[model samples]
Target: MSDSHVTPPPPSPSAGRRRAGTTAALIRAQDTAIPQADRAGSGEPPTPAQAFDALHAYCAPALIRQAYLLTGRHDRARDAVVRAFRLAWQRWPEVAHDRDPAGWVRAATYDCALSPWHRLRLRDRHPDPPSDPADRALQRALLRLPPSYRRTLVLYDGVGLDLPETAAETEASTPATANRLMHAREAVAACLPELADPAALHRGLLRLGSAERSPAPGSRDIRTAGERSIRAWTRCALALTVTVAGATALTLETAPTHYLAPVSPGHAVQGLPVPGSLGPLSRDALKLSTKLRKEAGGGPERLVPQAR
Candidate 1:
């Protein structure tokens, strides 16, 4: 992994920090700009990979943020974004032709968020937890919402998807989307009491705006466009490397397709195989074999049942 590719949090004190770092890293890595250059101008639309690169610029952040908000875990959000992309990749031919690909990702992402496994993961991560004032305040604001309203609000208010888009992705009608956005904003407005320093929060949002617009420090010499292209290339290379490694391992472990002439049919029987030849016999089988062997051991001379 690159130095910038933040690791997932261990189940320990630094988890939140790790998650935050990873989220930031992922956002930076994606280069945030979708292009329509690959649109099916001449013939069949571009393949899923082509569409993914085109759409990822516009939708990755929203997908990541929504996943993060829904999951409350950085790694889970990153995973969800990857899953959403995978779905987009699988359905790209149709999706690229659709009026909105962003909607497709959002719908897929929410499904990932609401899954039982994701819920269980959240529980495990936050069990018996004491929260920081900021997190507790955020949670209070979030809990004020019904699940559907909450999801809509997060996608719209938090993740920055507009109402129509949010609606399309969420499979909600326009009126439903508008209604949930209003209620979501209202719920957060009501929870202001728990939130620490309203001005500070506002300032934080401003900083986010500036930071997102500017190239990250220490990486400024490289143009954002160039950097993004490099990152995309890197991602593809890594995926290829992993695929090759896995294939090599599989090839090495598998039996040879062309076997040498059978060494000797008799050699197989001649070898006195050990007692546990069947990849470690189960305890019951071992015990039974031991008992049977003992029964057969009574002196060879012992009166055998001649006529049985």
Candidate 2:
């Protein structure tokens, strides 16, 4: 909503780099800070749109880097962030009211980026290796970890989250998460002996992230996409509801107002005009009619019954 609270990342890669997960202005602007004007009187809360804008501006850049670490592919990382924010915007009520809006978005981004489903995509199948040999080695090691283990390692080590926090975010018990983190470290150590220390592994992960440029979509772009998605879904639901209602109304209009007793079938009488039309003749009736016609119309054989 205002530029004072929303400071963007340093423009150029050459400008200066901080450790991963450092957003320049986020520390001061934490938890959707209220403006002086709002805080002065009435204690009015910022509108949903205002709150969403503030949250996105605060979280997006750092999240982009984290997503890059989660998925090595730049495009996939970008898509995951955009998709996550789009979802966050759509579910703004739940996200805005949550204790940690940033964490909610982070979890969504991680889930999207870490999904095994991305591996099936044709273009993303090939690996994009970093130019630096050490970075390349680390990337290979990270990829080798199982999705669960990989996620746990990134959360606990790379993002500076505690064991319980990582466990909660990954939806795993703390003990299981600890096991995953331990196994992940061992696996990475097997690849590169220098990363044996947890601190060194953390630095390695950050270096790997910084080496690759994360292509996170703009906050405005994500918000617009979310709004467009909501509009499409709303229109679809409305159209379906209208169609059902119209069908019901049409059925009601054409239906009978009252009941009438059903009538039985009728038979034909010779030389007498029936008041109403008779039902269609059966095969035997038609044949008998043909035989009677071949003889006299009023013959005694036709009138009298024969004893078998």
Best by lDDT: 2
Model 1: lDDT equals: 0.54
Flag regions of model 2 displaced more than 4 Å.
1-27, 30-45, 248-308
**Cand. 1 TM to true fold:** 0.44
| Model 1 Cα shift for residue 73 (angstroms) | 1.0
The C-alpha TM-scores of every prediction are: 0.44, 0.69
The clash numbers for all candidates, in the given order, read 1, 0
Task: Report lDDT (CA) for all predictions.
Answer: 0.54, 0.77
Measured on C-alpha atoms, candidate 2 has an lDDT of: 0.77
* Model 1 C-alpha lDDT per residue in residues 182-293, reported as the tens digit of each score: 6565566666643233333333223322222211112122124344656788999999999999999998889597768866545335667678544888899998877766
Runs off by more than 4 Å, candidate 1: 1-48, 122-132, 159-165, 193-308
Mind giving the per-residue lDDT tens digits that candidate 2 earns over 24-122? 354455444545665567767677766776777777777888877777888888888888999999999899778688889999999999887887898
